[model samples]
Target chain A: MSEQGYHVAILGATGAVGTRIIEQLENSNINVASLKPLASKHSAGKTVTFNGQTVEIEEATPESFEGIDIVLASAGGAVSKELLPEAVKRGAVCVDNTSAFRMDENVPLVVPEVNADQLKNHHGIIANPNCSTIQMMVALEPIRRKYGLKQIITSTYQAASGSGQAAIDELIEQVKTYVKGEEMSADIMPVKSDKKHFPLAFNLLPQIDVFEEDGYSHEEWKMIHETKKIMKNDMNDTELKVTATCVRVPVVIGHGESVYFEMDNQDVTADDIKELLSHSPGVIVEDNPAEQLYPQPLTAEGKRETFVGRIRPDKENPGAFNMWIVSDNLLKGAAWNTVQIAEELVKRRLIK
Target chain B: MSEQGYHVAILGATGAVGTRIIEQLENSNINVASLKPLASKHSAGKTVTFNGQTVEIEEATPESFEGIDIVLASAGGAVSKELLPEAVKRGAVCVDNTSAFRMDENVPLVVPEVNADQLKNHHGIIANPNCSTIQMMVALEPIRRKYGLKQIITSTYQAASGSGQAAIDELIEQVKTYVKGEEMSADIMPVKSDKKHFPLAFNLLPQIDVFEEDGYSHEEWKMIHETKKIMKNDMNDTELKVTATCVRVPVVIGHGESVYFEMDNQDVTADDIKELLSHSPGVIVEDNPAEQLYPQPLTAEGKRETFVGRIRPDKENPGAFNMWIVSDNLLKGAAWNTVQIAEELVKRRLIK
Candidate 1:
């Protein structure tokens, strides 16, 4: 695009995921000529580090993407809905980290390991799948590629960081109150505006995001719909079934999922599934039950790779198998995955 | 037995679940002539209160059950196997909370709400199902009875207390270490004897019990086998498929399960499942998404009833539906279930 490398602007640059995007760029091979960190008016003056240099955040506006080559948007859905379109109109490709455009007919919901080819077809905005769905797709992509996938049933142990910085602070405060034997109070969690707020310290909240009319939370529905869209076309097909229970736990960073999948080939054994995952890209198999090793949130924190473990066959069904999937919610689930898609677009020569 | 009532001896009286058993007995309608609180020699002199009377715990020995009419055993498996047969030999009916006798052909694993009739056929021991399985059986029994049951897939968020008082203490200590920015060290978690231990403070552990020859952990296997033995008469039938992924979370008291089940009757609606559980004996339905009402572990703590919520129909399978089940692990899972069986034995005149 210019004599210098690509000029990258990170929307929501002061937020949890946006900061991780900056850190990833420092280690990544992408040649970022200049970093434009954009945030809300409240965080406009804040400085964030990029490639060991402090970059002052600017108040995000429609015209902020004037000369940007790539826009990594992690601002909430409203900001993305209002500002991302202007970025695209200015000839910038946006890899959004929100649900704003995920289900749009023209946008492709991508997990690079699962559907990087979809990047070639992106109409200016390429949507990143939900964190829980992204890790599950990484673990199952190998198995699904080797043996066709039919249905998926998942239960997630998502971390507090997925809700953002305020929720993580709340968990820390609750833990301090619990340690001091004081009454624990909660102001934000399990849908901050919902009638009730539960502490994520030493507890599990089954509700993530808001509840839908059909009784499934928005997080659960996102997993169901996003997986179908990313892994298969024609999501309305009756043959492909995906269901999930998305829950919030006390973990601060990584998200863990207990995933059960039915394969079309009935004879795939647990060992066979493990072998496939070990060989798959962007997936690390940490399964060794004898030594009590598996993918844990603490172990996966700040890491870019998706970890798969606890591989086992469903004794009741020959076609079904179970595995544990974990990844840093701020990394692969959000920021890292967003950066990966941008890299893919550059690699394919699709981006200017 | 005696003029006052049946003589009840509680094994492992000083432990976490054992203490809750004493509390349940305090409010129970069963008339007690005497309360024999038995524990290891180390805790023999500890005093526990029952029905406003302070009872000293005696060292658990084979002779402790000489005149006991009923035995509520919450001691570890080794202690139960060593001393339970001695109690049975002395003519005391035992409701065991350990896994020692659950799989024995003679010992009927009973969840009173699901299979109280199995109590009559028990020779001496009526085994209590694992905490996770008991709550699931209570919620699903009514649905299973109205519409013939087929298959179940579940993932659990179990509390630290399920592992015992030591694990609870470990969780509390780990949380304190985390709050103070101290390096967290763990010695017992996700199975203490396993070579590696992971902190459960702000994280989740996928392995609950030691892994079997296959990749399934002992806890996962227990859920599968115990559910079949409790719900169906001929567990060998290939049609009854039960699979589970058991995980340990940071919660301290209640265990939560996300269950997906298929029924023979394809016409059962979400309302139909909710209506059945609401009227069921030991289940309390709390599914009102509009009001944000669901069964949370914090709300279910110290409660005797199993709370069911988040009832929704699976769109892919006409007969399949999903529900969230929660209960105090010590109460309904172990201590309360054991006490209920003892009460059932009294009500049926099956003891002595």
Candidate 2:
């Protein structure tokens, strides 16, 4: 490794995941020649502390990437779609944490532990998978590689933070009102711009995103399509089936999922899958039934690693298995994945 | 219906569901000659207000039903099993909320709207299906009657209250800690005796009950077996297959379910299903997508009727449909269903 440093820029620096990305990069081995923080105009004047130093947030614009060697974009899909190409055109390798470029034919959607090699085919810009997808891939890829994955059906217990800060605030306020036996009002989480908002403190909303014509939500569609792309690249099989029911829960930070999968190999047992996941990088196997050891959103919050438990074989399907997975939606789901991609870029010498 | 009501004894009346049964029965046509609220020795002497009058809670004993004409039991399976027989033997007709006698060959498992006729065969005691099963039956019975159901796949987004009052308290405490950026402590919900408790405020627990030998949870198995028992009595020629994945969510009250079903008739449409449900007693259709109207757990709380929404044809399979059904677990799932059975008992003159 060379001592030569690279100029880095963070897009959407004031957002929940953006702030975490900055925190994760602190004390890392990667050298930074210059640090650029960009955010929406509303948040531009604010200052965010990085490594104990106050970093002024600047307005995100195409010109902001002029001298940056690696750009981490978490601004959102709209901003990523508008400025990702501009950053790439300026010679900066962009790692976007938005859905904007994830399905783009030319952009490589990379989850470093699962499909880091996808970065080799990147056309200047790389895309980050959904937070929920990233963790599931991390846990399942090892099993998929050892055995053979056929079908995946996932039901997500996602947090409010997945929708951003306003959702978190809304959940807190709603719970306080509910506790006092008062009417709780909701204006965010479970689709803020939708026609109506429902209290999330003690409820579950099935619609995570506005419904598409086919009845599956946009979020559900993303999981289905993204898992196909990521698994196809990793497993080298284009026919792997994945279906997801993405739900917005009242949880503030961590996302939990009940995943049921059927493998092509019938001999794999729940213990065998647990063994495989325990050895997988960045995945912690917490599936001890006797001690009731398992992953939970509360414990997973603020942690970078994905926690898995409740592994068992499906009774109806001989080759099928069921498990529970939990992770900090803001950390491992968004920020840390983006940061990990940047670290991989430097390690692979993809960016200078 | 007579103004001179018979003597009524409420067994396990101090529970989450018991309180609601008292509320629903207040000022009803059924005469309450002497309102008796009974619970365990721990809850005895506590007073619960009914119809503007405070009723003293009594310790449940075999003699508790000596002169009572009807008994509503919401106690756990063990309590129901221990006491229900005594109540019935003492000339009181018992509507048991626990699963103690649900699949018992002698006990009639009754959902008033779907199987009120079955009340005639109750051998002194009637069983109420699990809460998740109750709501689904309300929403699907009509469709099944018309189109002939073949298979059902449901993923429940159940609330913490389904686990009991302590689970609800845990969720509240966890949310407070999450907002203050402090550690959360859990000791109940998702199986109290299980090794550890995790925050449910913003998370989902896939294992609702202890895992059975077959990998499916006891809760999941209950839904499957209960559906078979209930639907089996309705149509002789139809073969009904049911599979459920029950997940405990941060929701405090209502249980929401995502249900997919396939019918024998390919001509079935979402509008047709909605039309049948809107006219069906105990069911309210709230599927106006344009108005952003849907059944939410928050809105369904305290409501007696089951709320049905998100009704649409499944794009993947012809003649298949998907729907979102929400209901107050304490009401339709437990207490109200039991009360409805009492009403049916009185109507059928099963109880004198």
What is each predicted model's overall lDDT from 0 to 1?
Answer: 0.90, 0.82
Per residue, candidate 2 scores C-alpha lDDT tens digits across B1-352 of: 2356778888878777888888777835566777899999999999999878888999999988888888888889898889888987888888888989988988888888998998888888999999999999998988889898887777788888898877877888887776777977778877987766666766677778787765567898898888888887422333676667788888888998878677999997777888899999899999876556778888898888999987876444568776889999988999888888887788778887
Q: lDDT tens digits, residues B1-352, model 1? A: 7998989999999899999998998889789999999999999888999888898999999999999999999999999999999999999999999999999989989988889998889989989999999999999878888998888999999999999999999999998888888988899997887888889888879989899988888999999988888877444686778989888998898998999899999998998888787889999999998887888888899899999998998888889988889999999999999999988989999997
Model 1 chain A worst lDDT run, 10 consecutive residues: A231-240
Candidate 2 chain B weakest lDDT stretch, 10 residues: B233-242
Q: List where candidate 1 sits over 4 angstroms from the true fold.
A: B233-235
The local lDDT score (0 to 100) that residue B327 gets in candidate 1 is 95
Residue-wise C-alpha lDDT for candidate 1, range A97-183, written one tens digit per residue = 999999998999999888898888888999988889899989887887889988898989999999999999999999888878898
Chain A TM-score for candidate 1 is: 0.98
Model 2's number of clashes is 3
Per-prediction fnat values?
Answer: 0.80, 0.49
Supply DockQ values for each candidate: 0.80, 0.45
